[model samples]
Target: MNPAREAMINGWKSPRKGDRGRERERDITAPRHDSSSRISKPARQQPPAKSTASNAVGKYLTQDQQSEQFVADEDKFVLKQAKKKADIRVREQRAKPIDYLAFSLRFIDTDRDVFDDHEGDVEVDIPAPETVLESLNHAQLQELHEDLTSYQTLESNARNKEFWSALLVLCADRRQKLKPQGPEGRALASVASDVDNILSPKSLEQLEALEKQIRTKLQSNEPIDTDYWEELLKSLLMYKAKAKLRKVCEAIKAAKVELLRLVDPEKAEELEESDGLPANSHNFAPSPAKPATRPVASSSDAQSSAAPPPGTARFSSTGNEDFSQATKALYDREVARGVGEGEEIFAAEEAVPSATKPLWADKYRPRKPRYFNRVQMGYEWNKYNQTHYDHDNPPPKVVQGYRFNIFYPDLIDKTKAPTFKIIREHGRRRGESFAPAGKEDTCLIRFVAGPPYEDIAFRIVDREWDYSAKKERGFKSSFDKGILQLHFQFKKIYYRK
Candidate 1:
């Protein structure tokens, strides 16, 4: 312990003169170990020093330069916003165009009177269900059945229910006709005759109850005829569809009446009074007042008549009155086609009278049919025109073709097709012209159909028609799906060089 204490005290004391001199000499003479000689280590790069001159210049910048910089930033921002807004507007306003050809039946008003002269007219005799059914072959009957089923599924209106009942009656009549002497066939016919009663005057609750009862009978294995009861069940479904449709239509009508009353009380009252008329009446005018008491038919007479009740509304037996979503889509597509390039509306009007009164005018309402037509236009490009005008500066366009579309969805007889005829004015025959210089001869094209639709006509340029069946000639004349179309182009005339 004494030795260690003495050594520590000696180390703390100042170094001897000889030891200090030797150490200083060794530090001075030893090989210098600069930073490069030491072990290398990574170091972060120092940032460049900011120039005080630039900062001083910024502080002294003029007001106009700052304003210009701000304006440039604002312009960039505004342009970006405007582009965003334009893109949104384009998306919102985009819509498909309409094509006149290939139009939908839904847009056509089957009962619309072009002349508005059918007021107070007696209703035409509705086709007998048996007569219509008897004419249909098995395939046609099946097709009709399928169409009705699809229509009923789409909308359950009173008119649809009536058609459905007529179909069932037709089926029952066929079964009875096949085995008239059989008791089962007679029983089936009698049961099927009650289909109308099952459909009409029954609420949805009542129909549902009847359905439950029929199911219960079947489920319990009751001694009831399975086929007859099953048929009743089918009638019940039809009734349900009808009831639902009527309920919806009534609600819509009531709402419309209320709205009309709020807007115009007199029109609402008139509409209400018109609604009270016999549903079969085609006229919108108020009916003649009736006496308080009327003769009641005998039960036997009433039972024998197959006519519908006075309150029953009449509708087209062939197709639906309202447009479905699919039909609307089809209508939109057809309308989008629009007029072809270099074409325009030429003539659109009903046909002029030819001194012959229609036979069905006295029996049914007489109203003009409706039509849409177009005429193709193009430069004649004759020798004189070619010499005077270029492609950029063309001559006046001349009529080159005609397109006619006549709608007749409500023809009284479905068996008959519409017809058209050309009428020359001023007692002039075909190829005869009395027009002044520079004026072209024109003729009326009259379209004829069965009542309640009347004849419609249009004036057209008189020219030689190209009846070639080639598609390029664009000659089409046919009546299909309730539309009578007559499209044809005129033969071009070329001048000799």
Candidate 2:
């Protein structure tokens, strides 16, 4: 045995007992001491350093830049620690509601100017705002670049007046939102810059003139001429048919298309162009306060039409029947039976109904669309002020924000039946999150928007033993409580005038 070697290991003040005791003490005391205090107290964390952030599409760091950075080692470490120690007291400045409204108007005016394909022949091509150009490989980028250049050529060509007009309209739209100081509002500076270079003074003046005219036309009363009357009638009929048809189709589609948005089902909506513009969302604030002046209408005018009022729909007289059995029965008994003097009862019934029209299609036309959204600017409004809002409307609910604003696709006419889509909200929650209750359950919001948003707050419902189907989503209010302040894209909404 190597007695000297063993004796040396044992004798040379190993300090093993004290070291083990200290380690044990730390392991026992760690829970009692705030872990953050241990490191940060000694290092003396500095305040988090502020830096400029670009909203441009991609990250902008060369690999070598990290090495080139000339920051003091201790300062950098201190700043990093400080960021964790101190709560960031950032002053959030929200975009004006006008920014959103103007952007929306620009979207509408741009579409009308560029892509309102009455004949469906016009080639209006542009990538969506979210299109990640840098993410593409070189070949894809080259192809995209070529497509964009073609549009640029179209922008300059006087013959392609519509294309040019669209660009000018878009330019003006963005230009309105242009902040004289600070960052440009929702309007991209790059887009505004391009428009400036492309459009000359004469063209700019023409565009301004055209916008004035358009605005004037929008405000003017639409002539209720024969063509307008006939089309209005036609639209009413078609809308009612579609509305009645939608319920049945919706059930069928939901049963099948829960996992898919069908490309081409005759019953499914035709692939329409992007709703006026690319669906790019931005942070929004409430609309600017404006004094509203509404025109007073006679009670007679309001109730004169049998059709459902604008911004509303009247379901078929039959309640929840899968088919038009009552309508079919009436048709067969009254209108279907052609009349003469001997058939007095039937003839009299037919006369009262005015149901003797030759075609069966004419019999059950929509009860004269009373509520059509006539112009892009309509009389009807779905207001959300302190007065009208019912916070817990559509009960069994969870919306615990201080206040909320609603947004919609602008330029919807109340004379036509508008569709509903998903509506979003942004505000602080009572709790930290609404986790389990989101993306799975549907919240039937009673009073929401103008052309309302639906198929939102949506999640797959369970059919088994547990019948309860509600969702909790995103940052839950219960957990993420006061810290979770929500923000949404604002609107340029005014009270109905």
Candidate 3:
């Protein structure tokens, strides 16, 4: 080999000055893991300490005798991979929840509260109850509510043992951490009671750990002792107590004297009274005691009370009257019930009652007049004297218009009613001065309306009277404030071109 060639090769392979400095620094600081560091600096070795769980927990050993107290490269690699798998879960979470601080580029979140995924649409901003018995820090109160809500929503099923156990732990934590004798405690206790419904003796399958324990004991050949029997008895008693406690807590949580009272005072009392009774009682708390009947005016009303007609069931024989919602709802329910009872009795009887002495409802039945009756439709229109007219013509004056249109909205299969607006000038006005033609009419007398009221009955009597009615009256009142001087009963509508 040539000396020059050998020198060139060595120059390329030799460490650079900067690399040599780094190598020297590493050598000086790097830890030593030789056999001397692991055992003692002796050739002979005694038998190693027996391997045990967690390095023989509770056994103290001097530092001089302890094995190399440092992690191995193989163990470090294993731990790194295990932690990577654990962090993958936190990184994939949509809510970004964390047991400890973490960060991830792929972390996803949502528009709603994290817990909303469990309980659909939680109602936020609910005003706190006024009867709080203990003062709690903001964090404590927040956590208290969250745990209560979680426990309340957790379903106890065979497949949800983990959820039930987690909920039980949360409940126990809240019960212990919160003021045990205060309002917050009572509120939490009520929420916790809901668990009894899910985890009572009837749903024992939800407690997998306890069930597994029992199974293991039953499978064991070892003799059972009195302590085991006592344990089982205690569990049975607890189940019974919880079963009864659930109903009481549910009632208190729903009653006006407790939960509902904070939300609504008017209905609180009514609901609280109902709470004491069984939930299945449909007729619980009889409809609040009925009030005394008013004096009846005529026999038209079929009311059985001492009060006459119009006392409750119907209006006086002649004039118009309306029943209030409360009054009508109660009266209708009672009447319907009574009618049903009468039918049952009649069906069971051997003979029918004569027409002269029919059931009370049939004997004094009230009649609801139709909106448009077929009578007095041919009343003679005397526009000359609006005030002087026969009683047969309900209105003394009416507005006449040929161009008016009536509209009906929401009709099936069409966007518009079977009607159209038409306008024609019968007489021209000079500079807004009216020039009455042979026939006088108005365009303002028309009205457009939505469904259920398109066919409003109207009569053409006098346009002047109709205009005056609009200015002087309300549609709901009486006082002869009629828009027309004459009214026609609904018989047949006419079409003219």
Top lDDT model: 1
Q: What lDDT score is found at residue 99 in candidate 3?
A: 10
Q: For model 3, how does the per-residue alpha-carbon lDDT over 30-118 read when each residue is reduced to its tens digit?
A: 44344544554667778777777647554765564354333334443443332233232222111111111111100121111232121
Candidate 2 per-residue C-alpha lDDT over 407-439 given as tens digits, one digit per residue, 9 for 90 to 100: 222212333322222322244222233348433
Per-model C-alpha RMSD: 24.5, 28.6, 30.1
**TM-scores of the models, in the given order?**
0.35, 0.15, 0.16
Location of the lowest summed lDDT over 10 successive residues in candidate 2: 290-299
Residue 401 of model 2, lDDT score: 16
Among all windows of 10 consecutive residues in model 3, the one with the lowest summed lDDT is 341-350
- Which is the winner by lDDT between candidate 1 and candidate 2? 1
Regions of candidate 2 where Cα sits further than 4 Å from its true position: 1-11, 14-264, 267-497
1 or 3, which is superior by lDDT?
A: 1
Candidate 3: C-alpha lDDT? 0.31
**Cα-lDDT of candidate 1:** 0.52
**Which one wins by TM-score: 1 or 3?**
1
- Can you tell me which runs of candidate 1 are displaced by over 4 Å? 1-334, 355-357
Better of 2 and 3 by TM-score: 3
